[model samples]
Structure formats: structure tokens, C-alpha cells
Target: MQDAKSTRITFLLFPGITQLDFTAPAQALSRMPGAELAGAAASLDPIATDSGFSILPTHDFASCPPADILCIPGGHGVADALGDDATIDFITQQAAGAQWVTSVCTGAFLLGRAGLLDGKRATTHWGYTHLLPLVGAEPTKARVVEDGKIVTCGGVTSGLDFALTLVARLKGDTVAQAIQLAIEYNPAPPFTSGHPDRAPAEVTLGLRTHVYDAAAARMAAALGATT
Candidate 1:
């Protein structure tokens, strides 16, 4: 049976969001009874993802319902949004009253840019965790870090785990477990390259790209930081 009170989950949409970060969590939360899902953007238009897909925004900034939970998903567009006032303001406003404010990957950077993660223990994509201090957040290395009302998960696939955690928080362990079982949420990777610590040095170095450095520069420029 659905709960008497529905939980409103709003995901912030941008031009180049990583679709999995939003979709994974959206799917998990939607499975919870009485959970309402929405995708909000600056305008009511289709938004593109880094993975060559597009998703339509269901609500615009001014028209979005107050969020019970506000989620931000990360992608290459994150650097651009770090300097976007409309995006930052929307997050600030919605998060103020949200029961839980959460993010996946560098989505935490958006929360940090909105000044919500200041002094909060948070996590982001492994490639960008070092940048948390750039926005006043205490960087954490956990896959999912929950500090009060804020819950941040690391990297792309972590959104799945993060959403399950959110369900457990809002509902109960039993409900969360039931949902987990329904989805068959089990991860068994064939290799050990999930994290920097586990991956071989050569494997990690080979995969490293300049994209993060460029993004970091953009973030610094947007925040008026000298570095």
C-alpha cells in the first residue's frame, strides 16, 4: 500500500548530465510506495546526457514542487553548472526545505557550489574528490557518506547504492530490502578496477584523462579562486 504522505523527489537536470546517475536513483526511489519523481531544469526542454542520450525535464525552476528529496547528478556539464546562477539558486532554494539533499558523482560539487556542503562531510566521483575542499566541503572517501540530511555517493554506478540508502532512510530497512530484492541488486565485478586503490597503477594511469583538470580549472575560475 502507498503511504498516506508521498515523498517528492526532484532531480536537477542540465544540458550534459550523466543519465545513469539520475536514472539509477530515480528507478530505486520510484519503486518505493508513494514516491513521486520529477526532473527539473532551467527550462522545460529536453536535456542531453554525456552518454549520447537525452531526457525531458518535467518541471522548470520556478514551477518545481518543493522537494522532499533533491538530487543532483554529475557529468561533463557539471563544470558549466558550477557557474550557473539559475542552477545554483534552484538547488539552494529546494534544498532549504528538503528532508534529504543528495547527489551522485560530481553532483556533490553542485551542492557544494550552492553552499550547502560547507563544513559537511561529503563524497564525489573519485576523480574529483580532491576538489571538495575547493568549495568548503570536507572530502570523504566513502562510497556513500551521510551527514545529517545530506547524503552523497561516489561516481556513476554509486547512484544505485545511494538511492537504496535513501529509501532505507525515508522508509525502513524492511522496505528497502524488499525493493533491493525485487531489483536483484547485487554487484559482482569480474575485475578489481573499481577504485584507484584497487586498480593497478598502470591501469589507472592509462585511463586518466585531462578532462578533470580542465573541469577543475573551470570550477576555480567560476568560484574566483586563484588556483
Candidate 2:
């Protein structure tokens, strides 16, 4: 009893994926009318997340159905996943027939590796935005950037914003609004510093020195080797 109007949304799941990048969007998009969500990986084995937990895929690359929306979520694993030919091939194949191809955080790098971001304006986590050009993308600063059928967003929690935005596009504002209300999507962070642009200089510098400096370098090296 499958609905003819069902919108199939497939997410690429990989080891060390940022769980929030996958789950936040899944929460919003799955609530859209007639929306079906599927997580696909290379195999059915449990995929580990950066959060010290694992997620089981609904389908493997060989058995997954073509999707209306194909999303790639990023994490520490993306650097390693970049070197996996099968993973890149899967993304290439899935994006070919998807009505909308998208990514969150460093997942944009995966899309870029698949030759999807060539000459396109894209974005990723701020630390890695500068590396987008290595993959033939013009890095645009925004939580979400839509260049044609390709949509890319910034790091982690931005997935929630990206999902609601896409839901509004696929269904309608009212439906998206209702879903937002249902999920209580309102955001009021205790801190004023979310992005580097808004964060205190010392705070941003500390984070970059501690985490993103090394992470971005690894990502850059990965992209450089691939390109």
C-alpha cells in the first residue's frame, strides 16, 4: 500500500557520521506529508557515529530504491569515506536520479568529490568552507545554500534548518509550519556565539586551535588527494 505521492528521502550513512546531521533532518523531513525516510550504507552492518553510538541502515547500496531526495550527512568519517570508491560511486549514482541532491556539513565534500559541485556555489562547516574550492565549488557563506537542485548547509545543527527549508519547498509553507510547530523547532541558544562571525574572538580561536585546525587540515588533505 505505497502512496503514489510518497516522497522517498534517502540518507547516506557511513561510519563516524555526525548523528545530529542525520537525525535532525530525518525528524523534520519524515514529518512531511507522504515522506518516507531511508538510511542506506554500503552494507547492512551497524554504522558507528561520532557520538559513540551506531545506526543500522534500512538498505544497502545494492538494494536501496532511487530517492526523490538524497542527503549526505558529514562527520569525522567523511575524510576516510572520501577515499572509498564505492561510497563515492553510490553517491554519484543516487544523485543522478534524485529530484534533489543535498548534503549537511562536510558531506558537501562528498558531493563535491562526486563532481556534483563543480562551478556551483556551496557551503560547509565554517572551518572547511575554504576547502570547497578544491572540489570546484565556490564557497558561499550561509546556513543553507541552494544552487539549482543541489542544496548544502553548514555544520551539525544546521541540518534542522536545512530540513525545514526543504520541507517547505517540497510540500508548502503551511505544512512545514505545522511540522515545525509539532517539533517545536524554535531555537534560543543560551550563548550568543554560534558561528565564528558572532562568537568572541578568543572563543573562536580556542575552538579552531583545539578542533577545526586539525580537522580542516585533514579534510583539505583528503580533498587534495581526491582532486
Candidate 3:
């Protein structure tokens, strides 16, 4: 049975989405005392994720209910999604009524494309934070940045942090803490190079040379074409 005071949390599903970006937060938020989760896509068809698997969406854009919290998750597909009018429109419409508008990873770009991030302080994957300015957003450095009702987080794992933060805000710290304990959301990475700042210079440079430099250029081109 649905809780009478349940908060409707909706996630936008698309091809090439970073599964971790969506799943991490969904895992935490779904355990919230009064949370209801929905994954919406262009259709009810299964949407392919970056992880080489497909997820079936709960609703189509036209059928999805207005969300109390609307979240967009990012991946390589985001560069292409930036150009999809229907996706942007769906985000715009859902955000118009959502109590909280948010995104994980490059999903912030989708919010930016929808004009929701205009003049707002936001953050995304470190590799693409520089491009936030193209969307009229002031780039911020943090795991999660909150600009009033709009919240954005960096990269994939940050979604878990963002979700717990939101749960604390909407429910209570105790409830959020309980959820965290239940999930055993602990982190002990072997490497201290999660962020560019801490990562070895050579490692960062090599990653940029092979991946981010070209990826960011494509993102820039996409944002340029849209804006």
C-alpha cells in the first residue's frame, strides 16, 4: 500500500545512462519512509544503460505523474540527450511543479538545457564542470551543491550522498541516518584519487588525454548547438 504522505520521486530514463548514477540514489531514496519511486522514459520500452543492460521504465513521458522530486542521471548518452527536444521538454514540465529539482553527474546538463539551471549554482562531473557556464550555471566544487530547491551532485557515487541529504531534509536526520545504516553506505576506497585534486598528476593527465578531453569537446559542441 502507498503511504498517504508518500513523496513521489521520479527519475528520467534514457539510453546510455550511467546505471550507478540512477541506481545509487534510487536505492537510498526508495528506502525513505514515505518515498515512491518512478522511472519515466520517452516510452515504456526498456531503456539501455551504459552498463550494457536495459531497464524497463515505469511510465512514458506523457503518462508519468508530476514528481515531488525530479532527478536526471547522466552518462555518455547525455551528450546526445542534450539535443533531444522531447527529453528537455519533459524535464522542463516535470521541474515546473516539482518541490525539488535535481540531477546526478552530467545530468545537470539536462537541467541546464531545460533552462532550470540558469544563474543557479550547480556542479557535475569534474571533467565537465567547466562547461556548466554554457548552461548559464555558476559552477561549484562540491560533492553536492544545493541552490534553493534545485540540487545537483558530482559524478555517479555522489548520487547516494545526495539522496541521503535530501531524505534528511524531507524526513528527518534520524530517519535518514536509519536508512543509511540499513544500507551500510560505507566507503573505503583503495585509491585516494577519486577527485582530480587528489589524483596523481600523471593519472589525471592520462585520463584527460584518452577520455575527458574528447568527451568534453563533444559536450561543448552539443551545448553550443542547443544554446
Candidate 4:
């Protein structure tokens, strides 16, 4: 069992990472008892979110200290981040040593690329989920899937739900539920435009092309002929 007095939680930050993917859950984790939150980036500098939010990093991958928990939040930059040798080296090292490692959305792509998700069941943003098999992962459609110590969450906003779920698993449902309630998470969608099936096919197609085309091109460049 980990000593409750001090447990570190490291979050890996790359350029263009999704804002909410790291922030919402990061806030929750930071508040947990005996929790210490640290953001790892390319360097101890500011990294811009996908939405252009700026975050100052705590440490770089090279100098990062070990922790009990680790997280990776993904976005358009995932293609670049995943293919970086330094980032992958840090993740492979830290994840191998940590008690638990998790990712939100396209962050799973990083894990998959690093070979961490190989032989593990995982999930990612549905758009790029098709590529998981290429990296030897057992992909699932579930919003969140846990296989051993590694946990993964599906697309974008699902990071919030995924992090909450993982919090329940780690800190107990009572604690997680308390946080959820405190956050007023009883969301009621005003429109029925949530799921792929519900949205008009045209809208979905447009969105797919608009959002994913660049990411797809980047992925092709990073992955090349290798999986």
C-alpha cells in the first residue's frame, strides 16, 4: 500500500493538449488527501493547450521525479508528442514505475504508440480509436476501461467522467461522489445533439473532416509505415 502521507501524481503536458482533459480532473486530484500534482512538459516552461490556454510546467521529462500516479491528456498535438523520443522515454520509464497511469482521449494514442497499451485493454477518442489495433492494443468502445494499472478514457469531454470514475476507484466512491456532487455534475443536455447517431449525418461528416483530417495527416506522418 502507498503511504497516504505523500503520493505524487504526475500529468504529462504536451503542446495543444486539451484543456479540460487535464484541468478538471487535475483539480480533483490536487484536492485529494496526500496528493501532490506535478505537470511534466517538454521543459519547465509554458505549454499551450489545444484551445490555446497557457500552463506553466513543473518539470521536464528529463528531470521529472517519480510518482505513484501519472496522466496524459491528449489533443491535436498527440501526433507530435507520441512520436517524440524524449516524451516516450519519460512515459515508458515513469509508467513502468508508477502504481497507476492513465490517459484521457487521444492521450491513449501516446500510450498505444509507446507500447504501453500493448496487450492491455484501452479506449481513446473514437475518431482515432481505429488505429489502436495497429499498436497491439485491445480497443473497447466503453467510455472508460481499466486493464491492470493503466486506465484510459474516451474522447474529449469524457475525460471529466473518466477522471471521476478513476477517482472513485482510487479514493473510494464516497469521496468521488462527494466531488461530483460538489461540482454540480447533474447535467441535463438542452439539446439532443450529443451522440453520433443523434446528430445529422451531414453534421457528423463535416465535423469528422474538419476536426480529424489534420490529426489523421499528422498521425500518418508520425507513424509512417510503422505501427
Candidates arranged by lDDT, highest first: 3, 2, 1, 4
* lDDT of every model, 2 decimals: 0.89, 0.94, 0.95, 0.81
List runs of model 3 lying over 4 Å from the truth: 1-3
Q: Write down the TM-score of every candidate.
A: 0.94, 0.98, 0.98, 0.92
Q: How well does candidate 4 match the true structure in TM-score terms?
A: 0.92
Over 131-212, each residue of candidate 1 has an lDDT whose tens digit, in order, gives 8898789998899999999999999999999998988877888889989888888888999899989999877666665466
Better of 2 and 3 by lDDT: 3
Task: Put down candidate 2 lDDT per residue, 1-227, tens digits, no spaces.
Answer: 12359999999999999999999999999888889899999999999999888999999999999999999999999999999999999999999999999999999999999999999999999989989999999999999999999999999999988998998888778888988999998899999899999999999999999999999999999988877
Best by the lDDT measure: 3
lDDT for each residue of candidate 3 in 69-138, tens digit (9 for 90 to 100)? 9999999999999999999999999999999999999999999999999999999999999999999999
TM-score of 1: 0.94
Cα RMSD of all models vs. native, in order, equals 1.8, 1.7, 1.5, 2.4
Q: Kindly report which residue pairs in candidate 1 clash with one another.
A: none
lDDT tens per residue, model 4, 1-227 = 23368779899998888888888778777656678899998787789887756899988887789979889898888887766888888888899889988999888878777788889898887677777776678888788899999899887777778767877777788887877887777768887756665878887788889977667667756766435
The reply for model 4, stretches above 4 Å from the true place, is: 1-4, 225-227
